[model samples]
Target: MVFRRKRKYREKIIKRSIWQQLPEESQNFFIETANILRFAGQFFVELVTPPYEHKEMIRQTYEIGYRTLALVSITGFILGLVLTLQSRPIMIAFGAESMLPSMVSISVIREVGPVITALICAGKIGSSIGAELGSMRVTEQIDAMDVSGTRPINYVVATRVIATTLMVPILVFYADALALLGSYVALNLNSEMTISLFLNKVLGSLGFMDVIPATIKTVFFGFAIGLIGTYKGYYSGRGTQGVGKAANTAVVTSSLIIFIIDLLAVQVSNLLMY
Candidate 1:
């Protein structure tokens, strides 16, 4: 009986030791990942089932897309302008100044434009969605909607997600155009390139492959931003503090996701090109 008790105690200790080997952070990460996956699955399910919120979706699109134009415009213009100014001296030294339009257009279209635009949206739209939904959650407004037989997930989550997914690509395109225009302006500051000539060089440098891959990846960036923002906000803990945390986390997570997506997109684009 004594030996059996000792054996039982040893087994209990072994079990406890094994359990303790899994750190709390790791446990939380797994739990959070599972919840996010479940939330995403539910989003897809709700997205397909209808009682579609067309008005809400349209409102969200206007809010996300139109409201962000000024910020995107300024950032894109600066991006191209600075890139051109910085590259000009080097290009001149190498006697490659004439190739500036082609180089700038390819760089902006192939990588920088989509990534930078997505990051901007992630910071702006991601935080807004998180705070808005987090506030609703904290105020028990989401609960009220559920009690009233309104599916908050469908009305709120689906509309916002779809809006971001749709608007991000459009914003990227707009930003790219503005960026090229800015580059043209920069070129004219020291050179005599005509608009027609600049446009010709830019267009001539680009192919379907360059544009298509970049555009395709922006869609993923948008989806990730929206999905992450909604997830952070929807499942936020109660209280104003939680609302703040959700907004902050949403931005951080969405930005990280945008980079990851860009990395994968580059790899895929490279493979296709070869």
Candidate 2:
């Protein structure tokens, strides 16, 4: 009886301490952060212990990857073309026009391609997942799945996350290739450079360090986009407004996270290089 009373007292004190110490907004932020971390942890747990959703995963991959290809291709081509055109005058002015291929290749492969592609995916894929899941949540579809003993996290969230994680890297590679092709085209417009020589210069400028770190960062980018999107949607409130808010929040949050990840990746890459 005494121990029970003491425990109750301690719980009350702890609750009071939290409520008294933090502002309401800060409390909500902390609570939400904790919940997100828990959600991510749950994803990892469910990922390994699965009656795996292979079919759903494949469907998501096709949805996330193949469907996004045209957009990525156009954006990537424009990215490289614009970058080359913008840099050409500067290179010529410096009497280093011949080094343009190396400079552009390194810039695209090492940084620009991965970051820009990730931001695009965060806008497109992230918003889609958030809105879709938010709608499901608002419609009680997720609740119905729970009642039916269907693991929505595994079937819905896990599949999407895995698909993004796998596909974003592939997308980055595709974008990088397209960007180089666009650069080659831009280069030929101003001066004559054979495709063979351009390839040689681009390939020669890139090494293992340039490729591997960029590729690795895209995996994190994909994971962040998927995870944040699903989290926002899965826990969305009632009504259509909530669904819209979830989608908007997911895009904003995921974009911020992508930049954070890129910054950390750069720091780590620099450390490793040194």
Candidate 3:
């Protein structure tokens, strides 16, 4: 009995040490990620069912899209202009200013435009979704919906997710166009690259691989932002403080996940191509 007790105590010590060695932040991040995925899965299941809320979905789309155009357009233009100007000096040193249009176009289309647009959308939409749902949860509005026989998850999360998935791609398309125009303006600020010449160079370098992968990535970005926001807000429990915390965590976690997803997408794409 004494030997058995000693062995049991030793095993408990090893188990406790092993648990302590696990990074708390990493564990929390995975837990949060799994929760978001579960939310997204539930959303999709509800989304395909009937009693489709067309009007609500339309309203949500308008709210996400039209309201967000100005912010995305301005940021995209500035990103392109600044990226071009910054890259020009290095290209000039190499006597390769003629390569400016191609370089800027590829960079914008492949990564900059999509990633920046998503990050901006994450700040705008992610926090809003989190706060809205968090407020509902805190105020017992979701419970009220349940009492009223409304499926709150379907009514709320499904609309937001579908709206975001549809709207982000449109925003990305507009952003890419504006960014290219800004790049042209920046190029003319130094050298006289004609509009036709600038466009030709840009279009020549952009292939199906560049465009398709980048566009596909935006859908995942939208999904991540919507799901994370909804999950954080849906589970919030601490009143107004919970609302604030949900909003902050939604933005931070969604932003980090966006980058991670992008990295994984790149690796997967590389493997498929090679």
Clash number for each model: 0, 0, 0
- lDDT by residue for model 1 (1-274), tens: 9999999999999988976889999878878888988988989999998899999999999999988999999999999998999999999999999999999999999999999999999999999999999999999998999999888899999999999999999999999999998999999999899999999999999999999999999999999999999999998988989999999999999999899999999999999899
Task: Write down the worst ten-residue block by lDDT for model 2.
Answer: 24-33
Clashes of 2: 0
lDDT of 3 at 73: 90
After aligning candidate 2 to the native by TM-score, how far in Å is the CA of 126 from where it should be? 0.4
lDDT per residue as tens, model 2, 72-93: 9999999999999999999999
lDDT of 3 by residue, 30-112 (tens): 67667777777888888887779999989999999977899999998998899999999999999998998999999999899
For model 3 the local lDDT of residue 91 reads: 97
Candidate 2 deviant stretches above 4 angstroms: 1-25
Ten-residue stretch with the least lDDT total in model 3: 29-38
lDDT of 3: 0.89
RMSD of 1: 4.1
Pairs clashing within candidate 3? none
Q: What are the lDDT scores of the predictions, listed in order?
A: 0.95, 0.94, 0.89
TM-score of each: 0.92, 0.92, 0.90
For model 1, the local distance difference test gives: 0.95
True-structure Cα RMSD, model 2: 3.3
